[model samples]
Target: MLADGLSLAKMNCFSRKLRRTAPELGSSKNELVPSKLPRINGWSWPLHGFQVVGWLVYIYLAIVSFGIYIPLLPPPWNHVVHALMGIIFILHFIAHIAALTIDPAEAGVRAKQSYSSPVPLFDRSKQSHVIQDLHCYLCNIRVGPKVKHCAACNKCVDGFDHHCKWLNTCVGGRNYWCFFVALTSATLGVLLLAIVILFIFIQHYLDPNCLRTAPQYAGIQGNTTWLVFLPLAPVKTSSAGLLIVAFGTLMLSITCLMMFAHLMAFHFYLFYKGISTYDHIKMRRSKESNIEAGKPPDVKTNNKAPKFLQT
Candidate 1:
């Protein structure tokens, strides 16, 4: 009877130990599996600051262009100019939204993984490269030849372009078209605004009466210059107000135009070469590294002609 009782006690003790260790083992397993997807959006202070500054500049330019400059123009030209600007603005805004929101993650990562089933943890100790045999160690999946891991986004992007700090997103296969559209529209809009402002500046000096031909200015005297804040409220002022605003708009527009134009040109060059921004950057870096190593630059391979040219 004592033996039976002692055996029962030992069994109960063993069961208790098993229960404790089972929970520990389960917890460890859970720790190994990631519970959430890697962050794809760039949520940083610089992104927020860029967004704020961009909006402020856009608003200021819009208000001045639509409220003051456009009104100063005569007749049908004013209406036509307003419609054109509105279209360009809409295109730019829509393209920006699309580019910013689209998921540029690699096909396998997007299709196979989610918050509930996150990518498996990569064991770098056993591997030399993050990518081997077209399989990504970090993403733990097979990726395309052009797939690249964006450190900022913490995911692999298919046809990986460059991460745009302004948009706060990765530009890849999915969003590259939208990004290009946004770039093009923004460039056009700023260039148009600059040209209109320049025209207004010339009219302000040479033919001031031509600018005051709007219905609102019909009763106002020629010498009584006015600064129109809103359509309904035209504040009487000297030439200084109009000139100051015109000069400021011109300066901003010129600066933005220069930047956008350069970016557009660079992208066009990449497109003509049938390569992405990432590829161009990588090739350039390889050339520099070779130069540093005192090796002859492999121009034929590094800067190969496009397929069309080769054909």
Candidate 2:
């Protein structure tokens, strides 16, 4: 009886050990083995923060592209601007779709360093493994050759550049050309129209009817004329000039911000050991107590030479 009890106890211990080590698989192809894998749930809030900021840009783009239409402009220019605006909207929609379709967790792209394996390698035999390997852990989505994931869109995007929330689309390889075309056309069109309006305002400014008015310079100098009124001339102050300046400023600011972000991100990714912004932030937090107590990072304790490198 004692021997029998001993065997049963050993079996129970082995079963518990198996339960502790076994990696759980999910039902769907896209579902991840949550128990064994790392996760980026903390990143969702920051991503949503960026999305909220993007919505503001979208509203501005929408108002300028669709709501404000001028009848005085030539048919060709008007049609061109309208067409570009429509394209921007479509691109934005596609970006959102891409984000939803590509799940970062399933793709093996976790925001937190602890959630992902240090190497992020796979055998390439399993479909899920293949997908995750293609994605790489640094970013969130699996894309094809020559394609990269857009952080802003939170998905694996094709030929990806930065996401333009204003257009609501991922600037991927497939649509980069279109995005540039729309941007260039819209900028030129706004400048041209602003110039025309300034010219018209100048012409009216010089009219003799201005001098005979009861409030001398009343119509010419009213709040609308001075503050909001736009002249319709290329050379002088008009609605056209105002619009061109405003749009030009907007374009410049957004472009500069995007460029700065890209440069910073690229610099870190290339120079560092494939570490990301998320990793840096977490590392900092993890070491905060140690740093305050005058200790070094945990890495220092485990700084051993690899066998291959030693050889």
Judging by TM-score against the true structure, name the best candidate: 1
Q: Which residue window of length 10 is worst by lDDT in model 2?
A: 302-311
lDDT of each: 0.75, 0.43
lDDT of 1 by residue, 1-311 (tens): 99999999999999998876543432332224332346555443346667667768878888888878887777788889989999998999889888877889888888876734445443223322456567776677888788876655667888888888777878999999999998999999999899888988888778888787766676777644765754677776677878888898899999999999999999999979998987787677767666877887674444532322110
> Which residues of candidate 2, in runs, are more than 4 Å off?
1-143, 150-154, 208-311
TM-score, model 1 to reference:
0.77
Candidate 2: Cα lDDT at 146? 38
Error of 1 at 276 (Å): 0.6
Residue 87's lDDT within candidate 2 is: 65
Worst 10 residues of 1 by lDDT: 302-311
RMSD of each: 7.6, 12.5
